[model samples]
Each structure stands twice: as C-alpha cells, then as structure tokens.
Target: MNKQLSWLRLAATLVTGALAATGALAEDGPQAEAGSAPPEASAASAARHCVAELAPVNAGARTSAIKQGGCYSSFAAAMAAATDNTVALASESSPESVGESDLAAAATRVIGIDYDGRFYSGSSFIWYARNNFGCFGGRSYTANMPGSFNNRLTSTRGFNGCTRNTSYSGFFQTGFWVRCFPNCLYIGDFMNNQTSSKRWAR
Candidate 1:
C-alpha cells in the first residue's frame, strides 16, 4: 500500500509540472506575437500629419469662405494641394494691372510655413489663408501644432496678413515664447524643436 501511495505522489508531481509548463508557454505565445507590431504601427502613425487652408466666408463678413485641402506626405505636396489654380491673369500691357493683381495675390496667401529643420529643410507644414486682406489689414490667428508636429518646428515664415509669428513651448500658448518677425530662417536654440503652439498676426 505504501509503495502504491508513493507511486501516486510521483504521478501527481509530474502532472503539475507539465501543467505549469503549458501555462508559461501560453502566456509567452501571445506576447511574442504582439511585440513586433506596435513599433511599426507607431512609426506609421507618426509619419501621418495634416495641412490646412483657412479663409473668411465673405467680404467684410469676417467669417464666411470655402476652406479646402487635406493632409499630404510633404510640404511641396501640401502647397500644391492648397494653391488656388483659378487666379485671374493680369494684363501685361498695363503695369498698373500687374500691380493690382500682385497685391490681390499677396492679400490672400499662405499665413505661415513651419519646417522641421533649420534653413527650411525637412518636413514642412503650410498654413494658407484666403481673403486675408494683406499684411496690414487682417485679424490675428492662433493655432496649436498637431500632436505629431508639436515640438518639431525648427524654422518658420509668415506671409500675407500674418506677418508675425510667435512660437510657444507649450500647448495653447503656454511656457516659453519666442517671436519671429516676418520669418525665422532658423529657430534659435531656445525655441528650436521646442515649439508647441503659434500665433500669426500682422
């Protein structure tokens, strides 16, 4: 009877060990499978950012215009997508006509362009505004950088009515502030890659 009892104990020990091994393998299997996916997913998500165009709805209305365009992979692509192709051609026979057309074009133009590298290299974000009324006669506009673009700007330029750029180190215009008059060929060390928000104005 003692020998039989001893044999039963040995059998139970082996069975318990086998079950524990199985449990460990089960836990490790899913973890191993899932580990490789997040990095790739994170990279793809990071690469996706957006570009936007803004405009007032109507003349003297202060808020009524058709805004269009969407996200793109590069600054050049975004610029192409946002540009107005239906611009009226100025009559070259009259210098006054060309001057008027140039003024009109400048009045409704890109508000700001931010670059990820100094000297305007690397990825870029273009903010185009229509009906801005030139640099001297437009309302101020402020915007927060997108999640992927926050703290990524290294250079910037403002145009049309938005000729002044103020970069903030925190979202919603908090933390440190740096002013870029008309443009910054390279954001200084303090603000380089540290901009999270921006304000544009005449």
Candidate 2:
C-alpha cells in the first residue's frame, strides 16, 4: 500500500509541471509575435540619428539665429534650443507622411500660447511609429485649429494653420492647429530629426 501511494504522488507532480509549462507557452505566443517589429522602425531609427548629426554642421548660423530673437529661429535653431517656443503655420497646414489623431480631451500645461490643442512631435512621432509597424499611410493629421487647438495637435509643433478638408483627410469634427513651421516641418527637417532621433529611440 505504501508503494502505491508513492507512485501516485510522483504522477501528480509530473502532470502539474506539464500543465504549468503549457500555460506559460500560451501567454508568450502573442507577445512574441508582437515583438516582431516592422522594418519601418529601422528606417525611423536611422533618420533620427541623422538629425542629431546635422546640428553641429554650422556654428555661426546657429549663433545668428540665437543672438537675434527666437522669432526667426531657423530649423537648426529650433533643434538646438530645448526651450518651448510658439510657432505659427500658414493657411491649410497638413503634415507629411503621417496620420491624423484627435486628443482634444487631454489637459495640457501652457507652454506659451493658450492654443487649445495637443500636437505631437510630427516627424519623429510618425517616423518612429511607422518603423514600429504602425502607419497611417500618406496622410497627415486632418484637423481644424480655428485659432485654438481643442484636440491633440501632435504637440510637437507649437501651431500651424491648416484648413480641414476630407481630401487631405483633414475632416475632423474638432478644429485645432498642429505647429509645423517652427516645430516639426521646417523645410525638410523631417529627415534630419528622424535621423538624430534614431539614436534617441534605440
């Protein structure tokens, strides 16, 4: 009888261990698949790195943009200084190679302007996202900033002016501006910022 009891205990221990192992494997499956990032992430990483590299290319221009007021901060000036500045975009602003998002519900501390929108760091934001397998196609955020951002304005750009049209995918119920000029798209700053950000992201 004692021998029979010992054999039964051994059998139970083996069964318990097997069940635990199976459970662990099941949980790990989806997470492992999700871990398989898309190739875009690699590209985004490279882009961010390049942005950082370009900052030191010219020193005099940097000083000029700075010694004068921050009003005319060039692309380099914006990148070099970490201080928050209010930027204004022209009529009908649509960001490049990005998707539109609405975050008008979030509470934001006033960086400078009471422009009521939460903008993202457009270029770096999208580049990093695409490289990570998340993309919104050849569309920029389509929102309306009727002089104030009531939603997330991609938060990177202080403010840019854009007309909300469905064609550009700007058909949004809420109207808020995304800061493009001095914030994100300073005439091809996308590549530079993306390149530099690559190092930061990784």
Candidate 3:
C-alpha cells in the first residue's frame, strides 16, 4: 500500500510539471510571433515625412512669379511642400515617381494654376499618367500645364533678351491638335509656388 501511494504521488508531480511547461510555451507563442512581424507593418503605422530638393529661380529685372516655388527633383515633393504652404524649401524631392492626381482635390493648400512643359519637371505639378490614360484621350497630348495660362498670353523678354510667352493654352490635349496661343505658342507662366521654368520653342 505504501509503495502504491508513493508511485501515485510521483506520477501526479510529473504530470503537473509537464502541464506547467506547456502553459509557459503557450503564453510565449503570441509574443514571439508578434516580434517576428514584417517591417512594412510597422512602417505603415508611422507618419509620412515630406522632403523635397529645390533650386533658385534667378530674375534680374522682374521678380519671379513662382511665389514659394523653385526647382524640385520630383513633382511629388514639390506638391507636398507647396500644399503645406510653408516658407522653407525642401531638402530633396520624394524618391517616389509622380502619378496622375486631381490637383484641385489633392492640392488643397496649393492655389490652382496652369502649366505646360516638355519634360517632367517643367510644371509646378506633373501628372504621372499619360493623356492616353485619362478620359480616353479626351484631353489629348497633354502631360503638364502652366499655372496661370487660362488668360491671354503676354510676351516677355528673358535675361538674354530672348522673347518668351507669358501665357499658353490651359492644357495640352492629345489625339488632336488644338492651339492655345498663336503668337507665343509654347511658353507659359510658372505662377505661385513655382521656382524656375525652362525655355521651350514649342
């Protein structure tokens, strides 16, 4: 009888120890899984920081029309800085590529302006999408538009005494040809929040 009682006690103690070990593992399982989660999950929870690269727009006679605007490495960074309406310049343009977006809606803080350019950096804002992408080419051959070209264009002289257009067609249309300005066809204004504009013979 004594031997049997001792055997039963030993068995109970062993079972209890095994159960405690299992409980400990169960408790640690969730913590270990959580620690192994992907880094992107943490990044998604963090706030987005806006930084842009900028350069000066030099004007010897007339003050530059691009108020708070300048050369940005990328369009996305430019819009982020201008939308904030802060006076400080950006350190670098966002590495992300610019995409097609509704300026009026996305650029709540930025004033509405028109722009047109051959290259991506030509306008204060550049849509990432091609004209063939939006509205099935209803807005033909358009990529970028100037800020204030909705009005009549004026002829202005640059530093080298070369003539440039003060205004241009509102936006470039693709699929079909539409003339926005007759005398000064290609050049346009880089208005508020823009930095510098390149000379285009278009």
Please report the TM-score between candidate 1 and the true structure: 0.57
* Model 1: residue 128 alpha-carbon error in angstroms: 1.4
- State the C-alpha lDDT per candidate: 0.64, 0.26, 0.32
Which model is ahead, 1 or 2, in terms of lDDT? 1
For model 1, residues 1-202, the per-residue Cα lDDT tens digits are 9999999999999999999999899888876676565765665334422466655324444322324356665433455454554334322221111222333544346667787867765566766666545345666666678776888998887766566788999876789988888778788998889998887777
> Best by TM-score, which number?
1
Segments of candidate 2 deviating more than 4 angstroms? 31-63, 67-94, 97-202
Candidate 3 wrongly placed segments (more than 4 Å): 31-40, 52-81, 84-101, 104-202
User: Would you estimate the TM-scores of all the predictions?
Assistant: 0.57, 0.24, 0.30
| lDDT ranking from best candidate downward | 1, 3, 2
**Per-candidate RMSD, Å:** 10.3, 17.8, 16.4
Worst 10 residues of 2 by lDDT: 193-202
Which residue pairs collide, candidate 1?
56-64, 56-65, 57-64, 57-65, 58-64
lDDT score, residue 88, model 1? 40
Model 3 residue 145 lDDT score: 32
